[model samples]
Target: MNFLVYAGVKLFTLLLLMLAGGLFLKALDRLIFPEVDFAHELREDNEAVAKVVAAAILAWAIALALVLG
Candidate 1:
């Protein structure tokens, strides 16, 4: 039905937006911390890096929710 098609497209768009948001976060991290390796830090049990990433993700989710609404 047309509703099913619309729902599928909306879901696909949401998935793409989530992927883009993650890439944006990664790019922002690299831009802000050119020398620091967040992946390595996270592997080394760096709480600070985890917290920062979590905060960024939360912020991104909030922004997405607002936009979607």
Candidate 2:
């Protein structure tokens, strides 16, 4: 039960981090490339960004599991 709770917490944290990171990246893109039409770029490249964010979250989750399990 404790391990389950720990895993759940880690998963939740990982998701939040991924979401925040994705938003931050989008904001940075807007700031750096104000004329680039990020919404259109996002529509085209969302999958790539999602994959990168997922990879990052997964890495963090795995590390947390190893350390806390």
Best model number under lDDT: 1
* Quality of model 2 by C-alpha lDDT: 0.71
Pairs of colliding residues, candidate 1: none
Tens digits of per-residue lDDT, candidate 1, 1-69, equal: 999999898778888999998898789878989899999999999999999878988998898778776
Would you list the C-alpha lDDT of every candidate in the order shown? 0.87, 0.71
Write candidate 2's Cα lDDT for 1-69 as tens digits: 999998798888867866876687678768977886645755787777567556755876686567555
Backbone atom clashes (below 3 Å) for every candidate = 0, 0
Q: Give the Cα error of residue 34 in candidate 1, in Å.
A: 0.8
lDDT of 2 at 32: 76
